[model samples]
Target: MNSMTRIPLTQLDAREPKSSGPQQARLPSAADVPRARDTQFKDTHGRRFSYLRLSITDVCNFRCNYCLPDGYQCSDKTEPLTLEEIRQLAKTFAAHGTRKIRITGGEPVLRQDLPEIIATLKQTPGIETVALTTNGYKINQHIDNWKAAGLDQLNVSIDSLDPQVFQTITGHNRLHEILTGLDRALELGLSRVKVNAVLLKGHNGDQLNRFLDWVKTTPITLRFIELMETGQNPDYFAKNHLSGESIKQQLLANGWQQKIRSKDAGPAQEFDHPDYQGSIGLIMPYSNDFCSSCNRLRISALGKLHLCLFGEQGYDLRHLMKENKQTELESAIRHLLQDKKASHFLHDGNTGAIQHFAQIGG
Candidate 1:
C-alpha cells in the first residue's frame, strides 16, 4: 500500500475557535502518539499516517443483529462530546497532522446538529476531507443540509436488500428509506458513497453476490465486512459466521475475478472484479489481519479512546476533558495515540473476549 502524506491542511481564513485559547501548537512528530499502550501511529516499515476515523457518538439509531445487544445503553457516567469539544478534538488531531476526518456515530445521522458538527470540523486548519457514516435513517431528510454544510462523502450501512430479510436483520423496517438516502446522498454530489454490508454465515452471507450484482448498477463501492464479535449476539455469530477469506473465495467462485488493485492505505483491503463494472471490498479484521497497518484509533461516544478494537483497556480522556486541563488533555490524548495496540485481541467475533463496535467505533 502506498503511504499517504501526513500534513495538516492550513486554514487560510477561519473563525477563532469558541474554546477561546489556541489549541496546543502541535509538532509534526506528535501525530505518532499511540492510542494508549498497544498500537502505534506508524507501522513497522516506518510509514507516517494521516487518516483517522473519529466517532462523534456511540448511540446508533438502528439495532442491527450484529452491532448491539437488546438491552444496550449508552454509558450513563459519560456523554458524547459536545459540538465544541468534537471540533476541538478534530482541531487538535489536525494540528498533529490529521488530514482526512470521518465523523462516525451510533449512526451519525441521528445527531440532530450533525450538519453543524461537520461544519465545525471543516473549519479546522488541517482537515482535508470530512465524511460521515450512517444507517441512512435521516439521510433523506437532512442530506441536502449535510452536503451544504460541507460533508465530503458518506458510507451507508446496508446489510440486505430483501425487504423482509432487511427488516429481520436491521430490526427497523426501512430498506427503501436507506436506499433512497443512498441515492439522495449521491444525487446531492456526495460522490464517494460506499455501501458497507456486514457478511454473516447463515444470515445474509450467502446473498453477498446478489448484493454485489446490485451495486454494479451505480458507482457506489460495495464493501463486505466479515461479521465479528462486537455486540451481544454471540450465539447468532457463533453458529453462523464467515471469515473474510471465505467470502473472497465465494466471490471468486461466482466468476468474480480477483485482481488485487493498488490504492491508499485504508482499512478495506480492496480488490477489483475485472468482469464486473464496480469493485468489491473485503474488510477482514479476522482473515486478513491488517492490525499491523492499523493506524486508526477509536474514541467511544462516552469519550474513551480505544487503542485497538480488541483493546483490554483505554485511558479516560473524558476525565481530562471534563476537568479542563489544557496541557494534560493534549498530553493524555497524545499518549493514548502513542500507545495504540499493535495487535488486535482475537479473530473470534465474540463478546466476552472483544469489546463491541459501538464501544470502540466500527
Candidate 2:
C-alpha cells in the first residue's frame, strides 16, 4: 500500500474511476481469466493463486449483534505477530507466489503501532497490494498515522444509516460517528472506499435503496453483503438471510443498470451506476456461489492456514513458527493444496466457519 511502491489506491474497493473523462476499461471476470495447463505461478493449473487474506489480530472494539450476539462467550483478543514475524511470513508467501495481501482483523487499528506493521508488509517484495477491513469507528482518529504507515485502501462494515439500527446491529450507538469516519477516509485521498453492508431479511433490507442513493453522491463504493452461514449470526442466520438475487431485484427496482463485468477478484460482482459517481458492488457468495473460481487462502489468528473459509480443517503454522521448523510449514501448505475441497457446501447445509467470522479475518 506504500504510495511509493504501488499506486496506493484501494485494491479491494475500486469504486471510483481515476479519470473524470470516461470510465476505464472493465476488468476481466474469473471466467475470463485465461485457462492454461501450466499457468505462470506454478506447474499445476490450480493454485495459480496470487491472493492471500492475512488476519493480523482478532480484537475488536464493538461486539456486533450479527457477529457475536449478547452474552456471547468469545475468546480473548488474539495476540498480533511481531513486525519481524509478519515480514518473514509475507516474504515466505511471496516466494511461494503470492502477490496481493489484504490485512484484516476484528479491528486491526486496535493493534499497537499498526503503521509499523503495514510498513513492514509494504517493504516485503512481491506483495503488490496491502488493503484493510475496519469498522470505521476509530478510523478518523488514526487516518493520518494509517496513511503515513503505508495503509492503502479500506472496506468499512456499515449495516444501516439509521442511528438506532446501527446501534442495535453493532451493540453500540456510533452511527453518526461511523459516518463521520467514512467522510474522513474519503477526505484523506483514499481514492476508493467501499462500504460493506450486510443485509438481513427483515432488519435492514428496507434500507438498501436509501443507502445506495446516498452512496451515489460520494466517491465511496457501497456493496451489499448476504449474511453467510457462520455460527455467530443474528438468530443464527435465521433472521438475516437475504440472497444476491433479492439484492439485484432491489437494485433493478431502483433503476441501476449493469455497466459491464466486475474484476476477477473479491466476492462482490460490481455494477456501474448511470446516475451516481461511484458504482455498486453485490457480494452474493451465498447465493451466486463464486466458489468455483475461489482461490483464497486464510490464516487464523493462531497461525493455522485454511484452504477454504468454511472448511472445518486448518494446519497449524504456529507450532512450526514456535519450533523454528520452516520445512514443516511448507509441508503443511502443500498438504492443504493437495487435499483442498472442491467447494464449500455451506449455504443450505452447515457452514461451520471453524471459528466466528470476528475471530477470523473478514
Leading candidate by lDDT: 2
> How accurate locally is residue 209 in candidate 2, as Cα lDDT from 0 to 100?
66
- For model 2, residues 127-184, the per-residue Cα lDDT tens digits are 8777788888677788778777777778888888888888788887877777888788
* lDDT of predicted model 1: 0.65
Which candidate achieves the best TM-score against the true structure?
2
Clashing pairs in 2: none
Candidate RMSDs in Å, in order, are 9.7, 12.2
lDDT of 1 at 31: 42
Candidate 2: list runs displaced more than 4 Å.
Answer: 1-47, 71-78, 232-234, 259-263, 321-328, 353-355
For model 1, residues 1-362, the per-residue Cα lDDT tens digits are 00111112131111111111233223323345434453323444344356667777667667777776462465454456787677666765676566788888767776788889889888888888898888878678888898998999898888888888887777889988878888888788775888888887777867865887786667787898877764355677777677778777777787676555334466676666655666778888764447655556556665555455665334345544433454455565554444444555455432322345655457
